[model samples]
Target: MHAHRKTRPPANLGPWQRLLLLWLLGPLLWLQARHVRRITPRMPEPPGQRAGSAGQGSLIRLLVAGDSGAAGVGAPTQEQALCGQLVRRLSRHHRVEWCVLAVNGLDSPGLHQLLLDTPEAAFDVVVLSMGANDATALCAPLQWACWQSRLADLIALRFAPALLMHSAVPPMHACLALPQPLRWFMGRWAQQMNLSLAALLIEKVGRSMHWHPSTTTTAGMAADGFHPSAAGYALWAEGLSQHILAAQIASRHHPDLKPCSAAAIAH
Candidate 1:
């Protein structure tokens, strides 16, 4: 589903204020990171088959790409993560052949570079789970916007999926693993980045691009309180399936339209 835009200004600190804030908050941020590391053991991305086909219908080529969340880190296997969940849901209507291209800590620009390096392949749908790492790395909103725009351009130039779905930045403020000001800070940054991303998508890809908000709750968090639990992945997949179905309906009505083309989305 498309996200409504808010007209608030960016939340980044002014130059001098940023310097002062960093000088004061840097030590605390470091401490919080260390404390979180001590409490939350690193979890490997779920292992198992990444490619599979199911159901009997028109073939749907799907690509799930991004970071740890996309890699299904919290779940025991890919079958329990977002990719598997999505494939299962979509397979009810379409024979889905899905592949996942993700890593543990990839940011927006990193994902874009990876897509560029990979060989081109057409996909019926593309789902991206990103931005949390970017927020953690303190990527500036302007920088994130630029990278997101470039990523959109690359997608248009390359995969050109009928629908492109972007998972919204997670609710970092609600993360139990993060310490006070650090969580607060990352949350604000994530909000800013998400806003920038939404605007860019609306401008560039329009209706062909869908934004799915975080459906995760406190109880849906994994042991680390950072990644999503299996329940959270199910919720995410359910929402995504709805949007994909909508896009499929729209495409059916406009058969001549090139899905995800700049001109098509601009309208």
Candidate 2:
């Protein structure tokens, strides 16, 4: 009897294979995007104050900026969204003067442009939530890297936040609203862009920027099934609060360490 051999599929496609696959599936992907857009109701940014102060005594200036999630699209108001949750969580320890500058449909380049137009200001922390829109737009990994690098540079130069927290790109594969093939493709692209972002931040900003992982779930998604529901925002806010608090403790212990400098914290 002849011995049977088991074969495993390759983990990833070659550049040529990817190109060919894209070419073949381009029309279908386009149609899927159109269909999604047509069916999904347009969600406005949740209404709330863009700037507010919380707690008292010593000030911890914070800036939250980026895309729809950061703008609190799914939640009823800003208070139920990322900014409100984050501010509330952080306010437990220090007086928080938080400002949000997020816009729906904004990408990395748009964020950079927004920052360029805003007046220079110092912030103890700047939490950036982005990459989903960039992934949906099919931004190239290299381009993503460039835009991220530029954004980091601008933040460091202008805002000079002691800690720059970059919220991880959400899991597109887990987005229940997105259909197959399109979801698979976007998920892969998002992962690539995230990898590129991590590498770029490590190389350029070092310990200044902390890459945070997303802990969202399908059940925690909003009515649109695209944005984060209130529960999802709470989970995200908890993660950010922990990171900020840990950084604060570390800063207190190391008096000589500069928050935005390479020596501030370990990756």
Per-model TM values vs. the true structure: 0.82, 0.83
Error of model 2, residue 30, in angstroms: 1.0
Model 2 lDDT tens row, 73-185: 88889899998999898888888877888889999999999888876665778888888888888777668878877887898787766778888777675566778788777
Best by TM-score: 2
Off by over 4 Å in 2: 1-18, 203-218, 249-267
What overall lDDT goes with each candidate model? 0.72, 0.73
Q: Where does candidate 1 have its weakest 10-residue lDDT segment?
A: 258-267
* Pairs in steric clash, model 1: none
RMSD of each: 6.9, 8.7
What value does the lDDT take at residue 64 in candidate 1?
85
